[model samples]
Target: MYAAAGANARACSRRGRSLILPLRPLAWPAVTIRLGHSHEADDVFLFHALTAGKVDTGDLQIEPVVLDFQGLNDKASRGELEATTLSVHAYAYARKHYRLLRSGWTFGEGRGPMIVAREAMTAETLAAASIAVGGVTSSAYLAMTLWNPRARTRVLPFDKVLPAVETGLVDAGLMVHEEEMALELTGLVCVHDLGEWWSGKTDGLPLPLGSVVVRRDVDEDVQRQLHKAVSESVHYALANRQEVVTAVRGTVGGLEADLADDFLGRYITDLSLDIGDRGQSAAEEFLRRGCETGIIPDSLPLEFAPSAAAEPSSSARDGARS
Candidate 1:
């Protein structure tokens, strides 16, 4: 970020704003957060602020870094990024390589994976049968394993899943997140909702999707500042819906209002603040099972720092649900 026109102004580029919180002031080093399937609105608010200069660096400076939906966690592990959006599975995988700073995630009520067959779910399909799936840590894979522990699933990048499904390369593709409903246009039918299935298996609780994570090796104050600023930015972006829509179009390629609106509504958690007791517990149970089954190792901690979460804010009271 630079001062321009002798007016002391910052440039505005992406949809997100730079963290300019008043409470904590420091000329912090700029850091990058790789986002793939994070809340598009949050991404817009943040990316625009950091990259395009819409937001100022009052206490901290964050540089917006973009990565493919699949490469986010990988980049963080390689030290290519200090933070990134991660699926629970991706977080588990990355923990083996990097320190993790936990923040809010985009989980929702009853969202889950769909088998996504253009045709039909046949009983006999087995070896050599293909299925289009999202990248390594995507919720789709999480759903696949949870739904049927015995099945072996293949991991594919996000953009390629649709084309692969359309071409019949995979007999079926597993779809999750917002695409569970959106993929109907491509003749993709839902064989199951993994989140819903999980709910049935363990009562009513939102399925944990992906989260905003930072490297644990960073300074403690930096993490605290990030936690507060990011929380505020997301809340502020929700207040200015039009700005977020404009930012999404400008930064993330597609900017159609309907798509942007839907994306925002879906990924932006009304339960956006802290990981509630139930949510945290769910993470632990999931990790326990995932480790026991060899889906991931047990070294990962379900609670990154439970004591660090501050008291709940009134902002979420606006429309706090899932």
Candidate 2:
């Protein structure tokens, strides 16, 4: 389903403003768009409406694919899914096949990924110790790289990281999502909060973690509709919080009710709807930092589908051509 015109559009309009369109709309039959998301609770909550037929998808039929963030990132890299949630770090590699949608983002303010150890560890010791990371391409790993470029890492499933550290397999682990809450029961101590480190480094900018990306080959109108649908879905989930939480139905696994509420509040609150100016700046800074550290090859320009109220920001427009 890749399109030459779409690739050209991506190259020509990296700023997220003008989209290169076909001379005329191509005639195509009804299609089912494969949408990918993580199994995490916030992801489940945000996407519940679309999966449950609570939102109008226009003419597109969405078939949901739920997996770990790393799994989704892998699929996105190969362009196997039409749409999916991906770590912003992974997006650096997958930007060729997909463009970020404006809605359905996960950003952290004062709180973010944590480096946890079974026993207290100092910054110097943690930097030299082996650590379990959920994914090599995850934002958590990216943050760790920036925080401690000398740290040694091993990739494990996000759920397995804590256990690996508990058993002394790794000296520490970088964790996010529900894993953040599980640290206490595992008797792990937080050595460093990457979000806090990032916040201080960037003057309190939110940590841009994950975002929804759509395949470039998809029609522009379909992409816009998808963004609108996701925005509405988040709004709906917030409005019917109880219903959405109930719908998740133990998806978070052993998380206490209070902790589940806290998790949702932290990840999906206001930033889930649209990744406004602050989020965009955070993303740009991440790219800049990642590039400076050689964690990623280069800081690619971000191209998000335009929202109703604005065009892409001036920074986006200025750097897109590069």
* Best-performing candidate as measured by TM-score: 2
Q: Candidates' lDDT values, in order?
A: 0.59, 0.81
Tell me the tens digit of each residue's lDDT in model 2 across 199-259. 9999999888889999987766667667877888889998998788877756656767777
Candidate 1 global CA lDDT score: 0.59
TM-score, prediction 1: 0.73
Weakest 10 consecutive residues of candidate 1 by summed lDDT: 313-322
lDDT of 1 by residue, 114-179 (tens): 676666665556323566677656655765776667665556767677777788777777776656
